[model samples]
Target: MSDFGLGVSGLAAMFALMILRMPVGMAMLAVGYFGIVIMNGDRSANALLVTEAFSATANYSLTVIPLFILMGNIASATGFSRRLYEAAFAWVGGLRGGLASASIVGCAAFSAVSGSSVATAVTIGKVALPEMKRFGYSDALATGSIAAGGTLGFLIPPSTGFVLYAILTEESIGQLFMAGILPGLLLTALFMITVTLVTLRNPEAGPRGAAVSWPERMRAVLRAAPLLAIILTSIGGIYFGVFTPVEAAGIGAGLIILMALVMGKLPWGVLTDAVLDTVRTTAMLYLIIIGASVLNPFLALTQVPATLGEGLTSLGLGPYGVLLAIVVIYLLLGMFMDGLAMLVVTIPIFFPIMTGLGFDPIWFGVVAVILIEMGMITPPVGLNVFVVKSVAKDVPMSTIFRGVLPFWFAMAACLLLIVVFPQIAVMIPQAMFR
Candidate 1:
């Protein structure tokens, strides 16, 4: 077969393995190994795999992933999630659909500290689901809000997705973090708007609510102060060049551990669990990185993405047209693929195309993350949605899916706004760099 044909075959086999429920890293590794062997025999394949494994694993930039993951895991174990929820609830729980809105706000805050979408979903779900259910909120509303809100885990700073994007595209992680700020806030605004409208239209899902006492609200805010400090220090420091991304992550993780110790949240067992979780997650991500190393070069050899990009450029499509096309493709793929796997598989191909088309890599990274965030709440393969459903086992999957639709629309609208006015994503980063 032609080299191009070999690439195509490799892709088909990868997807088929995915369909059979194989792990994403294993699927990629398997396809990559066989594809190399088929095209150039056994010795060539082993040589490629050996080299890819060492180089990808030993990458210095990759160190940021585990540090960030350790930061998140420590934060999770330190009682910060509860504090975030309590703070948001105290301030916002007085509005209509207050608890639900609080859930989203809490999810956003939690996401600032935690990078995994499923972790955000499950962690916040444990805290907010019971409260919402007790307050007579519908299963759909409770499950949907948490699921959709959890997608912000990556859209916000200190995100694994952002880290990966930076490493892949060779953009400054600090600049990308700054670029995500407005877009992340826009998404939060959109989700809150969606929640308010839904509650107003159907009071059954969320009845009118009372306000909180100023004193209690202040106390809640105080409880959340440590987290706010960590977020600001990590993200703000990076933006201002006070520290590099890995250094910021280490600082954040250290602060979180200190807070946990002070608050009596980190007993010996809890500390052990936090460390173990971080190690496991970091190990899993490293495996995927190695697989991507083997796979990315093969995909590049196909030249399909470059050809398609050239075709689009040759068609005289404007930047907006190219951007729109990319979003549409992500939406279609989101239906079938896990976001991380999709990102790992597509980014090597798409990043070059995007840059070749004159889009800024940093801007495209945020935009790509927004699309991935949407996928986190999208159906069939929506990881966040599934997490919510798992937590709220009593809630029907259909109800959760239906409830998620409005938030999906809100995310889509946010994506459109970012595309129409690039400044929304670029302003903070540019200002910081300047």
Candidate 2:
């Protein structure tokens, strides 16, 4: 069989294993190992496996993953996430669909700390859902806000999506982190606007809550200020070149821990659990990275990317046309595949094509992550929807999916805007790097 044929078969086998409930990392590893052994030799495959696993685990840069995860876990354990929600609610809860809008804002804030969509959804959902419910917020709007807002976790800074993208593509993690800031804020605003339009269409869908006094609003902001300050200091330090990404992660994690301790929030039990959660999440991420590392070399040996790139180039679809096609493919895949799985599997194939077409890698990373975020809320396998469902168990799955539709379009619009004005994604990175 041709190298291309073998590569295609390897992908098929990997997907089959995944369908049969194999862990993504193991599936990729199994297929990649055997493919390499067939094309190269057992000695080569054995060496590759050992070196790749050790290199992936021991890379100093990867320490950012556990540190950032620890920061997020500690934030959640200390109840800092709830304070963010309260602050947003205090400011926005009296307006039309205010609770829903507040959920979006709160999710965005929490996402700055917790880079996992499910974490953002579960953490903010617990706080916002009950309040929205108390205020007679429609289940669809209430749940939809939480589900859609949770996706900001992947787009905002301190994003694991961007971190993983950086690791895979050899792009600057700092640049990718900067690239996401403007687009992330833009998407957050668009989601809030969706909430407004939905409430406007059906006033009963989201009723206004009692207004907060200016003093109360100030107090709420004060209460949430420390967490926001941590986000800005950490992310901003990276953008300004004051710290490397790893240093920023360390500083952020350390500060969060210090603040928790100072506030008497970091009891021994909570601290231990947060560290354990960080270890578990980090291990999962490293496994996937190591798997991708193995699979990437196998794909390289098969020359599938070269063949695919040349084939697409021959079709005479210009860069944007091919780019659009790839985006559509990601959208379709998003309906079924896990977002991280989609990234690990496809970036090996698509990243080269994207860069070859002269698209900026930082911009593409931002765009790709946005597409992944959309998938998190897309139907069928919309992970965030199920997360919100877990939190709002009484709400039907269908209702939660229904609620996220408008925000889904809002995301699409955000994607289109970034495409048209690539500067929306790249401008910050360029300015910072320049």
Q: Write the per-residue lDDT of candidate 2 for residues 142-241, one digit (tens) a residue.
A: 9999999999999998899998898898888888888889998999999999999999999999999899999999999999999999999999899889
Lowest summed lDDT across 10 adjacent residues in model 1 is found at: 299-308
Which candidate should be chosen as best, given lDDT against the real structure? 2
Q: Model 1, 49-82: lDDT tens per residue?
A: 9999998888777777777777777777776888
Question: lDDT of each structure?
Answer: 0.84, 0.92
Backbone clashes in model 1, listed as residue pairs? none
- Residue 46's C-alpha lDDT in candidate 2? 98
Best by TM-score: 2
**Candidate 2 residue runs with Cα over 4 Å from true position:** none
